[model samples]
Target chain A: MDRRSFLRTSAVVAAGIAAIAAGLAPLRDLKNFESVEEFLQKHYKELTPEEMKQALERISREVERQYGLRPHVRDLKPMDGVEFAYALNLTRCIGCRKCVHACVAENNQSRNPEIQYIRVLKMPNGTLDMEKGDHNYATESVPEKGFFYMPVQCHQCHNPPCVKVCPVEATWQESDGITVIDYDWCIGCRYCEAACPYWARRFNFTEPSIPRDQVNPNMAYLGNRPRHQGVMEKCHFCIQRTREGKYPACLEVCPTGARKFGNVLDPNSEISQILKNKRVFVLKEEVGTLPRFFYYFDV
Target chain B: MIKNYFRFLLRCARIALVGDWRYHLWLGWLAVICLLGLNAWCKQLVHGLIITGMSDQVSWGVYIANFTFLVGVAAAAVMLVIPVYVYKNKELHDLVIFGELLAVSAIIMCLLFVTVDLGRPDRFWHMIPVIGKFNFPGSMLSWDVIVLNGYLILNLHICGYLLYTQYQGRAPSKWFYIPFVFVGIVWAVSIHTVTAFLYVGLGGRPFWNSAIVGPRFLASAFTAGPALIILALQIIRRTTDYHVTDRALLTLRSIVQVSMLVNVFLLLNEVFKEFYTGDLHASSARYLFLGLHGHHALVPWIWTAIAFNLISMTLLLLPLSRSLRWLDLACVLAIVGIWIEKGMGLVVPGFVPTPLGELVEYTPTLNETLICLGIWAFGLMCYTIFLRMSVPILQGKLSKANETPGEINRVCPAIQSRTATST
Candidate 1:
């Protein structure tokens, strides 16, 4: 090659390499690289029982390693002939936010930048309009006169728009009438977040941080396990607890006994009774999500 | 024949590598910006999407907005292709390549914008067609994934075939590319329409739940895309010896003019539907066009875009725009104007009074903005390299007959002289 042309080519090459090197310098910030086992993990449904056991062991180890908490993690299966449903009595709810905090604690949600599954909407007595509902009402009070508390969470809809919009089938409706997300499979496109009318889903924008003592010992594959950054999460109806025949943390914490949960398929279940006899309604029925959650009033 | 094709690719690569100081400087600037963007992206990877202004409420921000606009730009290639290929407009006969090249670059940018927007970009393989789960026929996003990749491949094949044939000094087989061109025209529409469907299919976002979104997307895309081409063609004419006829620019101008009007008309229809009817769902539109409950972050931006569109549309309609200066101004106006209208004006409002009626305004963070700017720079660099390689081949300066690779520097006197003088 000629001297001048050679110089030009070398100069360009040098500049290019230098630029790329400088650009990649920030990669040093990637402290927690994924293990080969984690990276090559199969989709949730595709995993065999042995693989799932290994996965659960890995999660327990990860939780221990990260937070010094050795928790019991399991892949809880839904019971056959059971379609779980929730019923909330509006007249009994006192606008207290214990359910929200209990959920955060039980779900192993991030504490500093708190991730709460339940949002209690303080609504006026006159209208069903959610526009008038105040999510951020700060007062030292319980059921401030003339206002009703309406808690919103994942409806686990029968006709889930969120599931339909998911390009990767990351989030899907489970057999027991609960919507679930496979964090490992989710690409985090946030399309499901946009499709949900209830604003039920939440994305983990950063690495979830929880105090060591605050980490819930009990975990589920699709529920209360500590989530990685950049995945979607929501109320999976306390899957770890519920799949084991225990009530959801939110219902257990409701001081007024307003929250009710049971298998809708069972004729004598509280939820089935609420639906059959009580004056029950679902929020945003016009959107046609056909929610599993029912609201009722006994005033 | 295969050996000759390999030789053609090598020669093209060589041509791209050796350019004047101006080219080097331009490329250097782009590379630096791309690196800076890469740096920012790395930070985002480490920190996660918390670095961006997006939250659970406003899940999509600048990235999705840019992706939407660039899809329109990419689809605008069909605007030029239809006239030259189908209608046989001689003025744009040679110029159609430029539009296709732009489409190629714009689509790459579109894909990049989507990539950077992803929270778990590491799991991108999950969306792949066969190997991955591939939720086809159910998700609009999967459809988008199909149409966009299809359009990109279609454009690349057309451009590659035409250019390779030119380098060999042979007539291109009409059958190989002609059918694809027709398919491309329809494919182009599907790309933008599918992107529109991505927004419109979301019944949760009332601001985007309108029949007019698809037509509006096409209209705005045609306007901004052609407006950008007219400006690009003018720059190419000034810098290079390649002839870009005034008629070509004028034809594109006319397209921009009509589409701009249609774009405005469609926008007006949306406004009337939102404001005149004054439904409860119109809160987002009310927040956008006029401040709602004193939270008016986007009101100024929407107004500026509207003003730019109106002024540019008027100028494009006038005889004064027959002059290049007025035409240039109008094109610039239309490009920037439609960018805002189609981008932030459209995407942001859909999330403004979010599905829950909570007013959470979005403002893109520095890291997000850097990544966006970086993608744009990379796209521009790609277009520049594509032009650098293709122009010599189109002019017959880098044909197979040259045989000896060393003959390139001797034959291309314009480049050598330009480099010599610049140095």
Candidate 2:
């Protein structure tokens, strides 16, 4: 090469190196890297029984290392012959927002930039219009005047728009009618987040900053397991508890017996009775999500 | 055959590397911007998308907005392709390659914008074909992934084949490229249509659930895409010895004129429907055009874009735009106008009122803006480099016969005109 051409080539090389060097500066802040096991982990459905066991063990170790909490994590599968459903008594709900806090605690949601799945919209009595509902009704409130509380979470829709929009099969409807997300598998594109009419999905924008003591020990792989900085989490109907035959954290914590949860398949279940007896309606029925969750009024 | 291809690539790389001070400066400026973007992306990776203006409320923001617009730009290559291949317009025969090159760069930018928008970019392989669980056909996003990557490859093949054949000083095989060129024209339309489908298929976001989105996307893309080409062609004519005719510019102007009119009409149609009905579903549209419940972050943006669009349309329609200066101004206005209209104006409003009837305004952070600008700079740099190499090949200066680097720089006017006319 001539002197002029050699200078040009050298200049190109120097600029590239400098650019790469400058680009690498901010990477010092990066604290997380996928472990080999985590990186090579199979999809939720594709995971064999033994691979799943090992994966669960790795998660337990990681959680212990991070929080000093040796949590009891499990891959809670749906029960056969059971399809879960929820019903809420809008008249009985007082809009206290205890269920919101209870959900956060149970779900291991981020505390710093708060991620709450349940939004108890305080709607005016005059109209059932969701547009009229106030999400930020700040007062010493217990069913203020003509306003009634309607708590909304993931409907776990039969025709889930969120599931349909997921570019990867990161989220899917379980056989029991609950929509579950494989947190590990989610690409965090958040297409599912945009597709949900109910605003049910939540994304972890940063590392979840849960208090050490506050970390719930009983975790489900698909539910309350601690999420990394950049994955989605939402109300999975408290999969850790519900699949084990316990009521959801929100349902259990409600002061008014407004929240109801049971197997819709069982004729004697409270949800089944409510479905038969009450004047029930699903939110945004026009959107055609066909939610497993329903709202009812005691007129 | 492989050795000859490698030799062609090396010559191209050398041509790209060795340029005048102005070229060095332009490349340097773009490099700095790309590095700035890379720095911002690294920070985003570290801190997560918390650094961005996006929240659970406004799930997607600036990145997706830019992604949407760049997809349109990539699809706009069809405007030139139609005239050249389908209509057999001789004026645009030589210029269509530039459009294809621009598409290649624009698609690269689109992919970058999508990558930066992703929250868990580390898990990107999860969407890959076999190893990953790709939710094809079911997900519009999966369809987007396929169409976009496919379009990129199609344009690359068409551009690369044409340029490499030119370097070999041989007539390009009609069988090899002609079929692909026709496929590319349909593929271009499909790319933008699929991107529109990504928004329109979402029944939850009423703002994006209109039937007009698909058509509006195409209309705006054709307008903006050709407008960009007009500006680029002018720049090429002024800077390089590349022959860009007034007739070619006029043809592009006409394409821009018709598409701009349709784009403006579609906007008006959407505005009338939203404001007339004034229902709850029109909350997002209200938020865009007029402040809904006194929170209109996008009112100024939408109005500004509309003004630009109207002014550009009027200029393009008028005989005054026959002059190059007025035409250039109109093109710039159209590009900026459509960038705002198609990018932030479309993407942000869809998430403004949000599905839950909550009002959370989205404003891009400094980091986000830098990343966006960086991708644009990177794209321009790529286009510049592509042009730098291809212009020489087109002029018969860099070819198999003129193998020596010294001889490649010598202007052969006789060979240049013959090569130009033959192609």
Candidate 3:
């Protein structure tokens, strides 16, 4: 490498290390290379929470040292007592893009102008017709022309086709049912992106387009902040927020109260009540996505 | 000794790459410069996919299509390599080594495109440290990574070893040849199979979930990739002392012609499966072919692809066109035309209308398109350079192999006389 190139590479490494450190970067385990073979028998989930934390600390420090970037190594322990669930209303939805915008803002998504999660489709209510739906219409009025609104997000499927297609174990469903991605671990193969039935995942084609002032400071290393270009990302049920007992920003901001999110296993929860009283259906249920989002018809 | 070797190599390289190579070397250098410039553009960091015209509705764009196309380009080499290496078609076997070099370069392009398509190119390494957070088994993703990278390594090892022996003016050892042949066949088929699985394996996307997708990819790869090789070899023959004969070129075209026939058959088979079954999944196919869902944008392009392929095959199958330069040009056009047809026309439009029924069109950003062109140019550049470097080695081996048949005969009489006198 030329001196100029070397300096540039060093600067990049340093910036990366700095970003990682700020992100609560994981610790590196490079010192125990000799034990790699013996360690192969151990699965990461078997590690105690404390052990995982320590491992993350090493990962953070090592990323700092190697690339001069402080890569955030968030606590990999499944959110304590976390359960996966979602709900949707077919009758009330107007196909307005409120949920999509809410996801971007609440998730601190990049405004630097790239594809983000959350899409609103205006579907004609009576016909088995998709082509009749116009995504490009700028009138922005909804629930018109005998049309129904369907909001699509990560289905949090029990049998996610996206998870099954990842070449690198970059993204997978947590035991609690939330699909998580190792942002740093993904090789950007896009296999998972292509296989996703929901079009739920988004790749950062570039650094996020968010302005510095608009950047959400309370970012989780794994969940939000500045995503690098190329790796795939999708909704993680906002574990960074929800795990601490906060409602997802999208749910909190819903104008129509169309979205209901909670633990499916909780019988006493409002979602459970809604499920019992209403005829709820999933989108493309025949395809067996088992979407966490359920639709209820209003009489 | 190392100094002496370097000095000798300098002398050889000067002889090999200078004078007549001036134009090619300059062109290659231009490609290198373009690649460097593209790196700088990407280095600025894409903020999001919004840089490209891909909206939430149209998530995939040119990079993906290129990846799909390049997989065929990468796998194409094996289609050419296998018949020659395994079947012992002496005519095609002579160019097998060159085909392998092309395969290696194509894989590099494929990987590069996949890298540029991600959201976090930096975090890409996280997948490496075994059992990262979301390790899902029974995923086509796991298969894609394994086959693509595995085939790449397989080609590298096979090509590298063969090139080394050829450089020493000797045939690769017989032991290596048989395994190499098997790997070539399996790897060629696997490359396309894994790529097709990326699409067809999806459940929600009714258009992609078909059993016939993999075979279609393989058949088309064989047709388009080898046709390109034959054209490239002809170019080489004209510009340099690289001697591809009429008979060898004819044999290559024959392979190209036969594969194109299969390629068309696969297309028909796919159409039949969807149109005949009249299943719900058929809707997406209908949208693409007949523009049922108001995505009529791709109709003309798709039909043009079909027409070009048919006409190209007609020209190829006829002896008059086969021997004619104009027919060869038409074949080249058909090959490229199919590449675009399969890559964009077939691949992306299948999923354009999201399941919830919203249509978004994908228009590639300048950065994305430039990067695609740069990588493609780089692949071609790599192949050209490899040919420049390795062809001499291959020719030297051919010279020796050519003489060896007579050489044994010349030695046999002398040995026989000596044995008789001793008796």
Candidate of highest DockQ: 1
- Which residue window of length 10 is worst by lDDT in model 1 chain A? A31-40
Q: How accurate is candidate 3 locally (lDDT)?
A: 0.68
Q: After superposition, how far is residue A231 of candidate 2 from its true place, in Å?
A: 0.8
Instruction: Write one digit per residue (lDDT tens) for candidate 2, span B205-316.
Output: 9999999999999999999999999999998998798888999999999999999999999988998998898788888888888888889889899899999999999999
- Residue A153, model 1: lDDT of 92
Residue B337, candidate 3: how far off, in angstroms? 2.0
lDDT of 2 at A118: 94
Best by lDDT: 2
Worst 10 residues of 3 chain B by lDDT: B398-407
Candidate 1 is graded, for docking, as high
For model 2, the stretches where C-alpha displacement exceeds 4 angstroms are: A1-12, B405-423
**With candidate 2 superimposed using the best TM-score fit, by how many Å does residue B123's alpha carbon deviate from the native?**
1.5
Ranked by TM-score, the better of candidates 2 and 3 is 2
Q: List the residue pairs that clash in candidate 1.
A: none
Prediction 1 global C-alpha lDDT: 0.90
Give the per-residue lDDT of model 3 (tens digit) for B248-267.
77877878888888888888
Q: Is candidate 1 or candidate 2 better by lDDT?
A: 2
